[model samples]
Structures are given as structure tokens and as C-alpha cells.
Target chain A: MNAPPITTASAESPALPNRFDLTAAIKDGLKTALIMLGLSIPILAYKTDQSGGDLWLSPRWGLVAILCALVFGLRILLHAFMATKAAREATPSPHQATEFVHAEPNAFQKTSRFAIPFFLGVALAFPVIIYFIQGGLNESRYWVDLGILILTYVMLGWGLNIVVGLAGLLDLGYVAFYAVGAYSYALLSTTFGLSFWICLPLAGILAGFWGMILGFPVLRLRGDYLAIVTLAFGEIIRLVLINWTDLTNGGAGISSIPRATFFGLPFTSGEGGFAQTFGLEFNGMHRIIFLYYLILALALLTNFVTMRLRKLPVGRAWEALREDEIACRSLGINTTNVKLTAFAIGAMFGGFAGSFFAVRQGFVSPESFNFLESAIILAIVVLGGMGSQIGVAIAAIVLVGGPEILRNLTFLQAVFGSGFDPNEYRLLLFGAGMVAMMVWRPRGLISERSPTVILKERKAISGSLVKEGHG
Target chain B: MRWIQDPLLDVQHLTMRFGGLVAINDLSFKVGRGDITALIGPNGAGKTTVFNCITGFYKPTEGLIAMRKPDGSNLLLERLPGNSINWKAKVARTFQNIRLFSGMTLLENLLVAQHNPLMLSSGYTFLGILGLGGYRTAEKEAIEKAKFWLEKTRLIDRADDPAGDLPYGDQRRLEIARAMCTDPLLLCLDEPAAGLNPRESLELNNLLLSIRKDHGTSLLLIEHDMSVVMEISDHVVVLDYGTKIADGTPSEVKSDPRVIAAYLGVDDEEVEQVEAEIGV
Candidate 1:
């Protein structure tokens, strides 16, 4: 019925046994080896001591040669194998070539329903399980700290999900509100001598107010333009913090910020301390445990509020705005208010997380709020699937907690030699994972969404049915 | 056709210019209350422009658009912001191309149309978030209203389906249903029957006629389908080259020489006949 097929692969080019040419392999290896040497010169060739007192030149010529040899060997082997395989399968079978592109998922999808709840159970039991496994709170502090860090991102991801995921507004300066919250709490606590609890809500409100301020002019902008403006807003806030020395203390930041107390009772070793009030001996572990639960409760609150908001009128308005801004306007939804509300609510959560971050660390710095932090939070949202709350949590654990997990893998040194630090390669893996995820599941790890409003039983809508928005 | 003595919507010397190009030039017309007014012309003849201006999608370069409501209040539509027209002036519109909140469910699409009311009831989401009884009652009423429209549009079965997943005909119906949920005094439909098959067009005509008959909604539509326009429209306004050529009942406008000449692409002699028929 159609045009005749062109020459098949076997008829076009027959594979020969002499595919392994040593000379070509050596040429490719030499070129790659030279490029690696040129690239690694600055980073690997010279090293300065932490104190800037000593300098040394260390050459890894042997390792470079070994890596080059491995690359060359792998390339040649792959070429030969691929060539032979191609010749064998030259005559394409109709059945083999014509499977539907969007067929049902094979193995992984079948297990996802079980996997989600299993992971949730694990997350809920994480701290207690670790406490028992490590035999006491002392040994579990590191894991608890890591848990706190991951939950913070999960909260941030869920918060930003409301704006970027549901509302379809790409906000790159999310960290600015985070900074606002952190500073608000820091300044409130230090100057006015307020407690963390009082400063927390105040910080969130201040951050949300700032969110509306920034949201006003940029609400008219869509897609990449919105992203660029938000990114600039984030950088502007950072720059302001750096230049304004009196209020922010410039680069020095506000240090020695007061820690959060258990209600009015402090966690210190004094008479009115939490442990002292309870008639228990003051163990520093109490503070660590308290902070973990505090952040956990905050994160859960973020999740709960987000989930509830999804069913509200404003939440539906956000999703509608994301789908079609023109349609939204035609429906009499004030696009300005919808977009501003998204920014404010998302910023509110970020503010909450930031204040917690301040109380947790007992310090605030300009360094904490940066572009990289925003990117990482955005990465978590994107990798999680924009609108899925559970997806964001899992992505946080995998992306944020994954790198920390790598830090503990000391056995990696035996494989790549002692100089190899896994922490340095965390970003490399992050980039690779993001690229891989785009190719594999462009919608995200959890793409299917349960519609917030439904009739009868709720059905999970496929990601293909949803708009990813301008972002 | 019998009509109200006073025009519900009055457009005076409406002119829309986009830089050097004039889209609508000194256009003037009147749409009577509770009347189905069809705006028809050849493509690029500014049929949709009039609808856009009346619906506040575009502010005419020079015009006074006044809408006399049932309460005897007059609204200057052009003075209002685009989004506010739906709420303040009670004017809702459907796009030439279907623009349902495609990502949302059919019911959700209708609910979004009632956003202003629901938003107010929820105290701008503050009360809604707190799960107050007042917000719940408002939400329930909104859902009931959405269900009523869904039933009217014959899309009650597919109410839970994502609007984008609906068939083309249902999407058209859903767009109308969604607009109806907004409870507009005047519904501006931009080619609601554009892509529909014969049966769907018939359904659309019935739906629109029912809207006017049962709900007392005054419709100002931009239509390309002559059959639908002739069969249903109480009044027809014809435009050519951004200017109104004929304005009267369907038969009067249909037989007008200017509309025939514009559609047939006639020469100078026909143009004179058009000018004579228009008495300009």
C-alpha cells in the first residue's frame, strides 16, 4: 500500500570480523586521555592547604592512563558486540518492531500501589526504628539530622508544588521567601527577645507578604520570562542581604540565634529546662529528638494544608489558571489574586521551613538562601512529579537523602582509591539522574494524579491528560 | 421577532486598531434583552471583534458599550477590566476555540465558572480552608448548580471525566455549560457550532434556544454556520471589512444586498447596491 522499503541493514552494510582495530582504538584512547589531562589539570594537578599555607602538585598519571585504557577497551568491545548483533537482527521481524508505544507498564507499575504505603510506613517509623537499631539516641543523632534535612526539602517541595505544580507558575526565587522567614525570625527573636513559636508564624506572614509583593509585577509574565524574573528576584534578595550590613549584618549574618524551647520550657540544663521540669536528667539527646519531632510536625502540617487546599475553591482556581490563563480570566477568576495566593501560600510554607531551619541551627546566614537551594528544591519538585504530594516526599528522600547516604559509603574509596570523595560526585549523579528521569518518566516518578474533586469513587488521572503548564 | 423596546447591550462607534491594522472600524449595533443575536461575516470581517469588545476581552479604541440590566441599571462595559466583566457586568463568554479548563474534570470546570460566588462564600479561601459550615453549604450549592448545567448539556454521565478527554461535541457543550454556571445575564458564544457535525449543531441550536427560553439568557453569538444562525437567531448583525453592513432580523439581514455582495465577493456594481441597501 505504501512505498517499498529501502535497503535493509544486512544488505546495506555487512559486518566484518576485523572490527577490533587496535590502531583506531589507540588513537581514540590517546585523544580522550589528552582531553582528560587538560580538563583535570587545575582541579587535580595542584592543591592548596585549607589554611592557604601549603601548595602541592599531585599527578594521577597512572590513574588517568588506567581510565583511558578502560574507556578504550569498553568502546572497542561495545562496537564489535553491537556490529555483530546488528548483522544478526538485520532482517527486522514485524512482530518485534510494532509494539504500541504506550503499552501497559511491565513490572514496576504493578508494585507501585504497595510500594507507596510501604514507604510511608517506613518514613513514619524512621526515627524510632533508627533509635532502636542504633541502640540509643546518641548513635542516632546523625540519622536524625539527616531525617530533619530531608523532611525540610520534602516540605519545601510540597509548598512549591502548590505554585509550580498546581498553579503552573515557575518561581525560581522561592528561596527569597525562605530568607525572609529566616531573617524575620532571627531579627524578631534577637531584638525583641521573642520565642521561636511567636517568631514562626510572624515569619511566615512576613514571608507571605513579601511573596505577594514580588508576585504583583511578575504575575503578568508567563513561562520562561516568569522564571527569569523570579530568579532575578532571588538574586536581588541575596545581594541586598550582602550589601545591607546594619540589618542583616552583611556576610557575617545573624549568629547565636536563640534555640526553640519545648513550649515555654527551654531545652537547656537550667532549672526551667524541659528535662528539669520533667524531673529527668538533662541529656543533650532530648534537644536533638525534640527538634526532629518539631520539624516533622511542621512538615506534616505543610503536607496536610497542601492536601486540604487542593480541594478548596482557590486550589481549583490555581489548577485552572495553570491549565489556561485566558480561560481562567474568562471564568472571572482574578488571575492576579490566584497567582498571588499561590505565591503567598507556597512562600508561607517555605517561611515556616526557614524559621524551623533557623531555630534548628541557632544561626542564620546569607549562604543558606542561594540559587543552588532553589534549584535543588525545584529539582525535588520536578523529579517528584509537579502536583503529587507523595511524589515530592519520595523525591526528597531519594534526591536530598540519597547524597547524604553517599557520604557514609566509605567502601567507595576502595573502588576508586582513597582520594575519591563520593560527596564531590553527588551533583554529578544528580544531573545524571535528572537526565535519566526525563528520558524515562518525563512526567515524574509518580505521574498519575487523583483529582481533588470527584464524583462517586475517585479515579487516578493519567499524567498525559494533564497540562504541565507554561513552566 | 418580538423584542424589548430598549437594547440590553448598546455598542456605539466601536473601533479597534492593533497598531496600523484596524480590526473593527466604527462598528455600531444593539442587542435586545432576551434575544439571540447572531454576528456573522466572512473570516477576518471582525465578527469576533465585536463579541470580544462586548465581553470586555478587548477595549475598543473608541467606543461606548452600555448594557442595560433587568434591574434598570446601566453598566459601561468597556470601562471595566476584562476579568471583572464576568462578575461586575454579569457577562460570560465562550471562545471560538473550546477553552474549557481542559485539565480539570467536567464538574470542576463548571465549579470554576462559579468562582466569584464560591470565593466570596469561602471568604476568599480563608473560611474554605478552615472547613466552615458556610463554605460547605456554598460548596454544595455550587456542586448542585454544576450538576444542573451538566444535565442541561447532556454531559452528566461524563461529569467526572477530564474535560480534555471528552469528545469534541461534548467539549463544546461543556464549554457552554461551564459558562452557564457563571449565571451571566448575557452569554457571548464565539462559534459554538464551528466544529460540530449536523446532529451536534442541531443539539447546540436547541441548547442555545433553551438557554434563552428557560433561563432568559440573552445570547450574542459569532457564527459561521448559516443554517444554525438562520434557524435560531432572533436578530442577525452582518459585518464586512470591520464595519456593520446589515443589522436586522435574520431574513432582513440575509436578504440585504450588502451581506450578499460581501459574501459573494462582487465587483463595483454590487458594492453600490450594498451601499444603497444600507442607505449610506
Candidate 2:
């Protein structure tokens, strides 16, 4: 077979202006502005009931028109500057494309690394900041609930990252483990009258056991076939949950499930409850705060463990397996063990999150663990940058937490009127954002940083040099 | 001098069949310890098939492939899984087509070759994941070993570069270095000089000789380059139509009438005439 054209080397040559020049940025900005403007026009016109009004001068369209015009003007200016810069640079004669472009972190890479942690930290502290500023301790329950949701998804994203990102296993039905954890907690807690903490690890163990069972059959398969089997396994779990009506309570779901108590003390109006035991005033917000902290700790622990694993031999094996299974085997890596470990670890974390979900919500049902849950988790991993901890967290926030935050945007009602619901279009925006990100950066928002072993003499040669086989 | 000792790799009555077609029919050979054995053959001669069988890439339909391990134990290669074949059996191999991890760095590629060593140090522990003291020592040792091979292969300067970015000849050499980093008892190289220029081919020959002499590694190489085979190989095994036609010292194999006829495509009647003319 003829050698594939090497595109990365040519793109990296010093003679050629970087493709990420101002022109590209301007073009990108214009594209985003145009799309936003296009959607805004229809919504604004419809909301304002200005079908026959003048297109540009109408009060209904004034702000959007100005924004679109300003965006276009700025794009043109940026493109002009970039074009002038490119014209001044000397071009090299063409040569055989032998160089590779291994991905190295450029100037923008450091910014992204900083951005992810900063963004997550901000999101995590958002509720506390709001609580102090607004004195919303009375309404702290909703903020606490939001925090729990964010932390749960964050944990789930990290879990799925192990299977899909590190091992390159495409699991479309990861929610099965979540279901297992939730059900395990629900069944055991309700039947034995066990506390949430007792059932938590048990739930994780049960899910991990199920993960290994599924892993065994699909060990021999790869790519699409493995994905299909895992998908079916997920369906099977969901089906069992639906069909096992006597135990699960079927579609109706188990309600009035015992709320998780703080140690042995219940958070209730009773004399011997948590508030009375501690000699503190009774408030439902305290319970919300407690659940929030619990989930947060769990999420942090999951991140810490996953991060540690990535540096280990097992983690490296997973990456190698992802890149090329045959090569991994040749390197004396037991791919079966690698695959199984990834599944077990990923499912174990999923179980942890699932049990947390059950305890926090005080309910468990098949509806909670559907195909959509898998998609959202996978989307978080992909959109956040595969195998990236901070990226997954960021993606979960923007995709899951972003929509919820939009619910409190009281000002949007002034423009679109009370008839407009921002939440309805949040998904559409989320999808568009994903597509845009994919097109702009196929490697996700934050590409993995290679483990640096050698410090170079020259001004740290571009990763492209390494990618081209120069190393 | 140790040629009288039992061969490090002993393949007896080796046969491989693909459905109705017999690819290798009762091929038997011995690759002596610390000797470079070259396998040469015409197109579709199944030289690579033999290498694949020896490396456990493919199981022979019928035969015995017993490779001596460093610990003085016999490893039935065909019975072991491909991954374990490299680790436990200590038999490393390079493909005809370069199989270097293209996306990984040069150092990373070499470290990957020392997969078993690092795995042992890690003890597959959570502490290893944290790059703890034990893991750090392993990492240092792995880097040292990788650097050693890189310097030997004249790629130390490009240690931080990507494996795929190297020129074609360098990639071929890097593949060798990667295999050697495993510290295997037997190194199987499939057409090491296939696409290299004369200079690179000479470098490859020196590399192979050094590996055999300095490292005491036995070689089972498949090469179409007669120059490399004749120059470095102590023993030559020629395969024609998946059957062993000749096996002897380089001089003996080069003088063999069957090998000459196979290469020159002499007819049955002309074989006698050609042999008489060549005074073989």
C-alpha cells in the first residue's frame, strides 16, 4: 500500500504560518457569532411578534443586529492582520513528507490546563459563595442538591473515562453498573435496615462483580462487536430491573425509602434526632449540606485514585492497549487483564456514584439508569478530552450543570417574554457546542500530555518532531 | 565454539497447513545459542511464516518449537500466549513492517520494550500508580536502559522525539533497539534491511553482530538481502516452497547446488548441466 500523506509535518514547518493564526481565530469567532445570531433572530422575532417590522431598525432586533455587526467587523480586522503576517514569511520548497507531528503542548495548552482546574474550583465553590452573599441558607437545599448532581456526574465521568478513554473500549451501556449500585443499595438498605455508608461499598463491590462477568465474554472481541455486547448487557440489566417487579417494585419504583441518617442520628423533628442530639436548631438545609459534602468527598477520592492509576504500569498498559492491542501484546502486556481491570475499575466507580445517587435521592428506579445516562457520561469524557480528569469535570459542568444554571436566568424572560423556556433549547445548544468543539479540536479540549523523560538542549523541540519519528 | 551445545531454539518436524494448502511441510532446523541464523528464500517461500511460528504469532499445525529460557528451562513456544511468549520465554521479535508505536516518543517506545521489568517493579500495586519510591527506582532504571539502547543505536540525540518521526532507516534501527531493550535470549528480525540503503544495511549488520557477540543473543533473521545474510550469518537456512531446501554454514549453503538452482530458476534437465558448468 502507498504511504499515507503526512499532513502534520507540512503544517508544522517553520516556513508555513501556524494554522492557529489570527485568521483562524477570527474565522472561528465569526462562525460562532453567526450561528448565535441566526438562532437569536428567529427566537427574538417570534417572541416580540414583529413579523412585518423592518429587519435592522426594529427595536426587537436592535441588540442582536448590533452584536452580529460588531462580530463581523472584528473578524475582518483580525483576518486582515493575519494575512499581512503570513505574506511576510518566507516559504520553503516542497520536500518528501517524512516528518511526524507528535502532539506537544503549545502556548494554549498551559492555559487550558489552568482553565480546567480553575473552572472546576469555581463551580465547586459556587454554592458556598452564593450562600454567604445572598444569605440563602433558608433555600440552601436547591444549591446543595445541585452540588450533589454535579459531584455524582463528575464521579461517573471519571469511572467511564477508565473504560472508554484509557482502554479505548466504547461502552454505550455503562449505566448498567450505575443501576446495579443503586439497586444494591436500595434492596439491601430497605431489607436489612442498613445505613447508606454500609451499603455504599457493598453496592460498588456488586457492580464490580457484574463488570467482570460481562468482561469475560467480550474479552475475545474488539471494537464494534465488544460495544454491541456491552450495550446488550446494559439492556439486560435494565430489562431485569423492569421485569423483577416483586423486588424492585417495577415501574412504580420504591418510594418512602428510608432517608440516610447522619451516623445513628436521624435528621427529623423528633426529640432524639440529629438537631436535638447536637443541640442545634432544626433545619432541612443541614441535611442537604451533609449530603453535598459526602458526595464531594467521594468525587474527589475517585479523581485522586484515577489520576494515580494513570501513572501506573496498569494505566500505561491500558493506554498501549488503546493505541494498538497487537503491539501491546507483543510488549508482554496481558490485554485480557488490562481489559478486565479497566472494566472493573470503571464499574466500581460507577457503583460508588450510583449508591451515592440512591442515598442522596432516597430512591432507586430503572428509569434513572437508561441509555441517556450512558450517552451523557460518554459525552462528558469525550467533550472534556478523553482520559482527562479536569476535562471530564468541565464537560459535566457545561453540559449538565450549565442547563440547570440557566433556569435561574430571570433576565432572559424580559427579552423572550414568559412564554420562552431556555431549558428547552439547552440541549440543542449543548449538541451544537459538542459538534463545534469536535470540528475545532478532534483531540478534545485538552489532549493528553506525554510523560516527559528527556529534557532537550534546543528550545524544547515541537512535539511534531517526535511525532514524525525524529526521536 | 559453543555450536556443539544444544540449539537454543529447536524446531522439529515443523509443518503448517492453511486449509488445503501446505505452507510448510516438515521443516526442521536448530538455531544455536549465540549464533546468527539467517533464513533466506524466494517470494512466497514462507520464511516469515517460520519466524511467525517461532515467535508464537502463529501456531504450527504440527511440530515442536522448544526455546531455551535464560533460566535454563525449555519453553514450548506454540503453547504460550503471544504476550507471555515475549515475557516468560524471553524471545523478542521485530516485524518486517516497522511496528514502533508511532504516536509514542523514542524513549517511550524503548520503555515499552522493558514492559516486563517495569511490571515486576510495580508489583501491580497502588503505590506504583503514585510513582512511589519503588516505582521511581524502576522508572529510573527503565530510562537508563532506554538511554543505553538509544545511544547504542545512535539515537540518543533524538531520545525525546517521536518514534514515527524518524527517517525510514532510523525507524528500522529503532525497532531493533526496542527489541533488544527487552533483553531477550532470542531476537527474531524479519527483513531488517528490506528498505534500507547500503549504508543503513551495513549499520544493521554491525548492530546484529554486536547483539550476537556483546549481548550473547541468538538471532533468527529472515532476510532477502543476500549481502547481509552472507556477511553476518554464521549459519544459513534456505526455504523454498515452504520446505527447507538447504541448511549449513554460510560457505556451504552458498555453494549448494539446490540453493543456486532455486535462485537461478534452473529446469530439472538443466540443473545437472548448470552444476557441471559451475563445477559444484
Candidate 3:
């Protein structure tokens, strides 16, 4: 279930005068039904199929009728909802407004104090918890791998959050850095036989180098120009990977590159392996657990560094640049370098996550890093509220973990017809969720920002005041 | 006219052209150290253009805008790149449109202005992340400066509030305070009192006076409000059609017929007569 986003409105909305004219609501529904009819006639009412050189139309008027009815009913409900909301806002509740303002910051601190530790404990105990719940290693391995996947996304989200959320730079090619990191690690490990630990930092440095390379040419561009260029940058990286047969193996992908060792100790079942060293039975579960923990540690490191950076001068400069580049220059901040550092630092984290992906899969490929990955990561940051750190974490969990939960919605298939696939509805839900988020809370899930430094006491800034960044 | 005593900035023959359109054409002015200088002009008279050129926002086609540093060395503002005018020469400015980090707290807005010092102390964020740098001490000093400015601007109480949440008058004062955090030798303000009510602007006048008196920072402002221009300005420079028509003390410039004609407007025939009076 979605969390209630409007705490203040929830408390005061019932006090508003509630009125609905049945005739007006029915008229509104009738209009929507007419529109739905016009839309569904060609698409939903019939299926076009060609067989034996003949075109045929199979009518499905029942499906059309159900969809039209649903829309009409939903529209009526929406009209009433909008009416009540408008009425509530029309009433000037000065006392409630002041109380909400004073209470917000304290509420934030209290929730985070509880939430952060709870998340840490959940994360640290996740693999073990799943192992017990699923009854055995064989059954739980799927979930352990899913945990690693979610954490990878969480790390990527946090990394992109720095550029898009805090710095307000629209980068559509973040996956290029991830690809650079993965390829660097794969090449270094396979050619030179360097350890994962040795290649990790080098991979990050390589990705950061690429980040600056991409950053230099696009320094003057902003908003849409910046986005288009970055998008092209991502495509260029992908194309090179696909065509560069000598270096990248040309899209067939480099398999058997390497599996990560536990600090020079492999997780093999043989002698001197992790199982033999621990004097336990040889089970592949150890490696899954290790990978999960490894990514969890890495993701937490990203979060910790980002949190620390927010308090530093460089981070403040990024936020200031987001507000106004001219003002930043007036204040003596070298906007060029501030922007470059943001790109580089953000890319460095992406590089780390990319290399981790390669090591976990024991393979490297161009197909793994794509623009879709960058979009999902960017979407996570924006949905979390641009500059809110904890919000990013929660959003990553919902987006990445929500799909896993969706796989279990078999009951929905029973309720709807057998033709209805729960898996197919995920996309529909995603689209609906995004549209709803934009209309009701455009800023994000957790929009209010807590000031880093306070002279007296902390105060929560309303999301309406925050700029989501044009770029 | 008499020369400026202990001049802080001398801008000479500054010209800025956007392809064929000239925004500022061969304008010159001198801002005295520890004095409040006002640039008063009619709408579209290139007041902001001159300010932009001075602040290194726009590259003048031809100019010798020299900033006299505290060490008695002259640094050419025109040649210096964007931002070094503030970091190297200590010339800070505010926009006509308030450009505060509206989402950030008032304290953070001020802290960002002291980035030059704090960045070096933090080793450009590398050592600071590791907790191995002198950033802690530098940040304390920066915050102290911010607090001082906040108190001076009478915004200490709302230091934690977002800059955008403040009313128009407080936002203007916060912009100045944010500018002051850079420890500038000359602070350029563009229409700081444009949106403020009479009472709020009266407070702004007191704030600007206190800044000059207490910090001894040179103040250069572009203002349409004659009350603010005539009251606090040690010297006033009046511009018409991108040309300086009157450059003298406030009393002298206030009485100049050219200055009055530019503001009050004159017919096409009277324009030449007023121009002739200035001997251009």
C-alpha cells in the first residue's frame, strides 16, 4: 500500500464541507464514458488477425463494456475527491498551518531515527531471514540474488541522485560510466589477472575519467541541450561496445571473466576454498550471502559518503549551482569545477556498482549497461524527492523490490479472467503511479527538505519552494 | 569633477556589444573605497549591463576595469574570469532578480559564499570526507561570519528557514547577507529595494549604511528609487542611452538638468538640448 503523502491534509480534510451534486457527477461520468467509447471501439472491441491471406475481426464487446464502466465509475469518484480537496483548501485554517509548520521538522527527525536503524538491521539480516523463511538454501538463493539486485539499484539510485537531485544536472548517460567501469574491471582482471579489490578503485578512477571527458564538452549546455547530449553520449558508448570487436569481444560478451574472491580466498568447494577454510559443508549459499553483503556494504559506503559530502563545501556548492549558477559565480564558486566534480563523483559510484555487477555475474557485456538502466536510476532519484537521501533509499526499495512482490499476485489472475496476467499489469501500474505522483505531489514522495545546518532549531522547508532543476 | 578619494575600482572605456547591438558603450566610472556609489538611470539605459561588466558576468569588448586590492596591487577585472573577480579581487554582487538558494536554509546560503576558503581547508572535499582535513575549523569560522551577517541583516531568527520562504524584504536582506559572507572589498547591488515597501526599504537603507560603516566595504548599486539614490549615495552616476551624463556628488547630480531630463523624459528636440548641456 502507498504511504499517505499529505499528513497535514489528512488531519484537516474531514473538517471541510463535503458536498456532491448527483446530476453534475453523472454528467462528468457520461462525458468520460463517451470518450472511452471512442477510444475502445477500434482497439479493445476487436482483435485483428490475418489468416490464409484473409483479414478477420473477432469482437470482444464485453472487454470494452467493462473498461468503459470502470472509467465512468472512477471518474465520478475522482470528481468528488477533487471537490472535497478544493473545499478543504478554500477554508483558511491559519492555526492548522502554523502547527503543521512547527511540527514537520521534529517529525522528520523522529521518523529517521527509527527508520535508518530499522533499514540497516533489515538489510544486514535479509539473506539469513530469507534462508530461514524459505526453509533451505536452494529455495532462498533466488531471493538472495534478488536482494543483491535491489541493492545494486539502490547504489545506482544514490549515485545518480548526486548529479540529478543535488547538483541539478540532467545526465541521461550515467550508464556509460557504469559500462566504462564494468569493461575496465573485466579487461583489467582478465588481461592482467588483477584482483577484484585491486581493480575496483582503478575501475572507479577510469569511470571518473570518462565522466570528465563527457563533462568537458557539455559544460556550457543545460536543461534540454544537456539531456540530449548526455543521451547521445550513452548511445555512443553502447555503439562502441557493440562494434569494437577487438577490445570488447563485440556484444557476444566476455564470460568466465572472474568471480569475486573473499579477500584472495575463492568460494570454491575444493581445498583452501571458503567452505574448506570454515570447516563447513560445501554449499553455494555462502557465495550468494557474501555477494549480498558485499553489495550492501558498498551501497552503505555510497550513502555514507553522500551524506558526508552534503555537509561539505563542495556539496553546498553543487546545491547552490542548482539554484543559480550566476549567483554561485558571484559568490566565488568556480562553477565549472563544481559541476565537473559532481559528474566525476557521481560517475565514480556508478563505476563501483558496475564492477560489482560484473564480479557478481562473473561476466561482462554491453547489453548489461543501457539507457534503460540510467532512466530507472534517474526515476528513482526524482521519485524520492530530488535532494532527499533517505527518500532515495525508500524509492529504490519500492521500485526495485515492488516488482518481486508483483510476481506473487496470482490471486489477481483468479479475480480478473484467466487472460489477465499480473505481470503485464506492472507496467500499467508504473505508468499510473507516475502520473498520480506528478499530479498530487510533483516534488516527490518525501519533498520537504531538512536543513543541514541550523543556528537555532531545525525547520522543514516546503517542497513548493524547491526547484527540481531544469537540466 | 573631482577625483574619487582612495578609489577602489576604476572602470574605463567599457564597451559591450551583442553582435551589432551595443548594450554599454564606452562607459567609465570610479567607485571610492568605503563609500556608497549609486548608478541611477532610466529603463534600458544599460545600468545592469555596466554592473554585469564590472562583476565579470559579461566580457566587455574594450575596457580597463581595474580593482585595487588591499595590498595596493591593481587587478584588471575585465581580464579576470568569472568568479575570480570575487575570489581574487574580492568584488561581490547581487542580482536584480533575487537568486538565493531558495530551497536551502538561510545559513547554508551564507556558508556557500565562503566556499573559496572552506574548499581549500577541506582539500577540495577529499580530506574532508576522510575527516583528516582542517575543514572543521574553517567551517566554524565560516558559520561565525554567517551568524554575524545574519544578525546584522536581522535574519538570525530564521537562519534555519529556506531562503525562498522569506518575504520579499527579508529575501533582499538575505541576498545582501549572503553576498557579504564572501568578505568582498566592493559589493555591487542591482535594485536591492525594487520590491520592498517603504518601511522595509527604510530598514534596507539602514542595513546598507551599517555594512559600509561597519565593514568598510565599497557599495555600488543600480537603483530606480530616487529616495534611496539621493539619500545614501556618496556619489551618483546618471546614464542615458548607455552614456554617462552626470558624474558627481549626490547633490550635484540631483540638480543636473540632464539627470532630471533622462528620468522625467524630454521631447526629441529637448533631448539634444539636454545632451548639449552635458557637453557630450
Instruction: Please tell me which predicted candidate would have the highest lDDT against the true structure.
Output: 3
User: What's the TM-score of each model vs. the native?
Assistant: 0.87, 0.83, 0.92
Assess the local accuracy of residue A337 in candidate 2 as a C-alpha lDDT between 0 and 100.
88
Highest-DockQ candidate = 3
- Quote the positional error of residue B227 for candidate 1 in Å: 1.0
Order the numbered candidates by TM-score, best leading.
3, 1, 2
Task: State the lDDT of candidate 1 residue by residue for B1-280, as single tens digits.
Answer: 4444768898899999999999999988888899999999999999888888887778889989998888999999999998889998889999988897776788889988988998889887777788874888888899999999999999888787788778788999999998998999899999999889999999899999999999989999999999899999989989888988888899898787778888888888777876886677
Chain A TM-score values, per prediction? 0.80, 0.75, 0.88
i-RMSD per candidate, Å:
2.9, 3.8, 1.9
Please state the error at residue A116 of candidate 1 in Å.
5.8
Candidate 3 stretches with Cα past 4 Å from truth are A1-21, A24-75, A94-103, A106-109, A417-420, B1-5, B267-280
Give the per-residue lDDT digits (tens) of candidate 2, residues A213-328: 98899888776788788889998999999999999999777665677788878889788999989999898877887788778788888888887777666776776676567666
Model 2 residue A137 distance off true place after TM-score fit, in angstroms: 1.7
Report how large a share of the reference interface contacts model 2 reproduces: 0.44
Candidate 1 ranges beyond 4 A from true positions = A1-121, A417-419, B1-4, B272-280
User: What does DockQ come to for candidate 3?
Assistant: 0.67
